[model samples]
Target: MLEDLAFPIERLGQAVTDVQLLFEKYKYENGIIFGHAKDGNLHFVISQGFFTKEDIDRFEHFNQDLFDLVLNKYDGALKAEHSTGRAVSAFVEKEWGPAAYRVMKRLKNVIDPANLLNPGIIITEDKQAHVHDLKVMPVVEEEVDKCIECGYCEQSCPSRDLTLTPRRRIVIRRAIKRMEDTGDRAGRKALLKDYRYDGMETGAVDGMCGELPGEH
Candidate 1:
């Protein structure tokens, strides 16, 4: 099934090419490199020294270049698993071309013209919209206020049963909460969706996954 849908061998080759390009461009000093080549998705985390403003600009350039090479070159979508949010949505046009992007823009306008639903994400007229200004909900904030950061959740999570860590989920909750406090509704929404939820269930703890009423 995976080989038939979006995770074919060709896609995997493109992902490998993309990662190699990034490594060569950045001279890959120190960073964690991991991802699923079978799915054509990869992630890298460099040291703080590589995160300066100039480096960010360079990174954005690299991102675009890599996107062009991988998506266009391989005829693959820019985003397969992840939703194109504020961070990567700006490149959608480049990946999908003007015609498809226009259709998406029109759909967004019809469904959420007020931009109140989730602004500056997936679609935005303003190219300068910062990552801080696109939050859509506040689930994370509510959760952090409840957690004492005692690390119990980490110790309890069964992800370690598979040699995995659950720390990222906790961090994501806190980060989205901070974004929510800043009044960035679109940003919050983007973060919320990252956790694979439409919205929080009533009376449910922020990070805990619960079925939305009527969803089941």
Candidate 2:
């Protein structure tokens, strides 16, 4: 689980300590916390598994605890540094209160009344939408699993314009692996038709990705 959070500068010291302690309570000792204190902005990343009901329940409880602390204790922003997509859309009202949320809905109605622009993203009626589509990252292969899909290698790939970049190659590979695992033969065949050219034939295959920094 990763989140970008913000709090008042005065509470920076306490907030950081509290968050670390909260993770410890959850037994997530590997939780990483980092960001800038100048803006009281912190970004934390923690590895978690949702493969079991116990894992899901634990995450839900931890999420509630963190949100209560941020919203009630410190009055902080749940989404401080990134797009308030479906992940935080359900909490918009909790963060801004009902009155401001209503104004936002009215403004959205005036602007995109048709609801064609990124619907169920910034504002959503489904409270559990975020939990519904939890992504399970299957290990495709040891070499490709390490890619975070950050797209940093795309700019440097020699065949980026001609074919799939390093990131896209790995993405398609993973998708194909998922489809195969799920027995989606038709979908796999359709994707493989394009994958032959975009993912395989046009590659320079010069180990440029390996030379780039980090696991990717």
Best by lDDT: 2
Worst 10 residues of 1 by lDDT: 1-10
Instruction: Show where candidate 1 strays beyond 4 Å.
Output: 1-8, 31-33, 36-51, 128-216
Pairing residues by index, what is the TM-score of model 2? 0.84
Whole-model Cα lDDT of every candidate shown, in order: 0.55, 0.80
Per-residue alpha-carbon lDDT of model 2 for 126-162, expressed as tens digits?
Answer: 7765676777766776788777675788899889888
* TM of each candidate vs. truth: 0.53, 0.84
Give the worst 10-residue stretch by lDDT in candidate 2: 207-216
Model 1, position 70: C-alpha lDDT score: 58
